[model samples]
Target: MSSLFKEVDYLRIPYADIKAATNNFDIVNMIGIYHSKNVNYYVYEGELFRSGKRINIIVERILGIQEVQLLEGVSVISRFKHNNIPTFVGFCYDKYLGGYLVSECEFMESLEQILNITPNPSIRKSEYRIRENLTCYHMLQICLGVARALSHIHDCHAIHGSFNSYKIFLDKDFEAKVVGLFENPEYFPLTRYTCYVDPESECLNIFLTPKSDVYSFGVVLIDVFCQQHAADQSWHYLEFPEIPEIEYTHFDDNIRKQMNSKARPFC
Candidate 1:
């Protein structure tokens, strides 16, 4: 641990160490840039980012930023105190790499990945699957989690500025922790562009506030219920317009009405 980090209460980490640990951006360790979230992504050292004696680090490449932006974002993320969001640990700079946002790396899969592979495919045929009391449980949990994250930031007078599946993750216990929004400039900015952002695709033009998060959350809900996936092989709900709403109001109702009822069960 660096003495600088130890001296501070949040986290103690050095930018050089994270680069070295991830093999200096080696392709072998490269997890693939999740371009969906506006920033270029390479899941280094696996989704779990554990350092020597400290917590793990979620390394990402946020295209545009300086120390000022990093600190500004840290000030906001650090104020978030909720189980649904990862604790804001600290931030760092790397001349070799871009500025880095370090947080208490949580172990979990994203809700997008969780619903991507549904055991029951037939359910997607209906619009009502979204409000289904049973299946929507996952959606409901995600909604609550997102609400909490948004509320937390709003309480601190900060805006998420980027809201999407790529910016959110599901912990081992299935808790949603919003991440990578303001942290990565180049990537996550575009992540919000899918919806929360205005048509122009600019940061100031984007609306990542709580209401915007709600809008993104609604899109996520529909995707999870419909089992829609994009041809690009990214987020399960990347195909937003085609399947934003379930075919019916109730899961049982959709079961009987889905025009594609003849399609294979969601396996």
Candidate 2:
């Protein structure tokens, strides 16, 4: 990981550049917010006009250790070039308020929002085309896109510390793009929409591994197929663990078990 950072080439943007682009982080231009009381990083969405072209960007206001760590992580993450993964833009460091890590803004709705039928599209056009529910074809496309993104990241010897429905975005065309790749593990938030967390991660003794990613992938697949939130079902695994390993052979069984009986007709 250390070697990966040494070779990373990044676009260093000035604080004034970002401020001007976002209108001093004005409320009117603010399109979204991602923050928590415990975390110092506050993410905001705004349109950036660069070279006379309007570009959507997500800016993360970073302070203290987050600034150093995230900047280093972003160095490597920005090098990624994949259709299924979100592209990294640049970063800005300020003398007073700290720095900002910027990435290409996802204009689409999150998988969670889509599943819950409460999508908040960035524009009016996307809202009109967004579906209330995902079809089998849509689900398959999502799974394949996520799988390819994960494979590419793993091939690069990096882990997508944060992988969940909220981190997966679907454009108006329903093409999937996995976000939050190479995010700090400590700052990652917990979600109830999907239990796409590795069971081993709960144990202090066990460090995160690629197999952990495989486990989370299984959970995500189950959630997508069933169109169900895994938060309630996650407790069952804690109460009694049974599955030795998740494999392609177990796909049908897992989907069938998790799917609501009412959805049987559709299946």
Candidate 3:
């Protein structure tokens, strides 16, 4: 009876309404950051309206597995409703445009900032371009949310396939949102980052199971733990010396690569 509370919470947002929020989809008002292949941005408003709403959009390749990701991934992630997970808007295609994914726009930097924000005097802290807080609680929430999300997908027999810290976007309130929801029965990359991936999953096959995602979560757990100790904790690692190295041999090889190359996210 008490367990039911976890599964019942969900947001009921219509796809068309999200479209309308973006001003019939205009590039001018799109608040997005540019990448090599695709573009991820938020829709604020355009010439179409006097005032507008902000939304999230992903412009990915029209071909290759990415196309499948947009179609199947959105359908998969969109199935489960969770606050930590970003709300999926839907997919759009037209003759002029290859494809576009519409969803809730979350405006926040990333956990990547932890390196600078949290100084690791042990690792010899260096100045960074940006500043942000990466509290221990924040790290815990990331794990909890990702775990819950994976559990939700596994219930449907769907695997995340691709998982990484970069793929996890942080919202304004510092909530973690894992990207790449669709399923790819065809192919999944073996290594996204040399250090973040699991050593075993690094073989040749794409991990199509919830346990695999859990393994990836472990890698994240390790990274955050390291950061917490080095910076937030007593600068002890500095004197302790000999901080063992970490190796994520199994992180997705293609999530970030294809996402930037063939995916060619045009901002």
Estimate TM-scores for all models: 0.61, 0.66, 0.53
Comparing 2 with 3 on lDDT, the higher-scoring candidate is 2
Model 1, 96-123: lDDT tens digits are: 4556655565454445445443233321
Query: What is the C-alpha lDDT profile of model 2 across 1-267, one tens digit per residue?
Result: 455344443466677878877678765444333322223434456667665787887666655434455556676578689998766777766556776767675565557555652344542233454333455656778899999988887787777754666567666677887766364334333321224557556444355566667777777776676555544433433443333333232334444543557565434
* Ordered list by TM-score, greatest first: 2, 1, 3
> Mind sharing the TM-score for model 1?
0.61
Q: 239 in model 3: Cα distance from truth in Å? A: 39
**Residue-level error in angstroms, candidate 3, position 82:** 1.1
- For candidate 2, give the lDDT: 0.59
After superposing candidate 2 on the true structure, give the runs of residues whose Cα lies further than 4 Å from its correct spot.
Answer: 1-10, 19-45, 60-65, 93-99, 117-126, 129-133, 181-195, 232-267
**Of the candidates shown, which would achieve the greatest TM-score relative to the real structure?**
2
- Lowest-scoring 10 consecutive residues by lDDT in candidate 2? 30-39
Candidate 3 per-residue C-alpha lDDT over 1-267 given as tens digits, one digit per residue, 9 for 90 to 100: 233222322322343554465555555433322121223323232211112644344322232224434445555555757765656655554434444544554453445444332332222111332323444455556678777776776776676665555455556565776555446434445423233344456554455456667776776665554542211222222433232345433312333343345555421
Off by over 4 Å in 3: 1-66, 93-99, 114-132, 184-195, 204-207, 228-267
Give the lDDT of residue 73 in candidate 1: 64
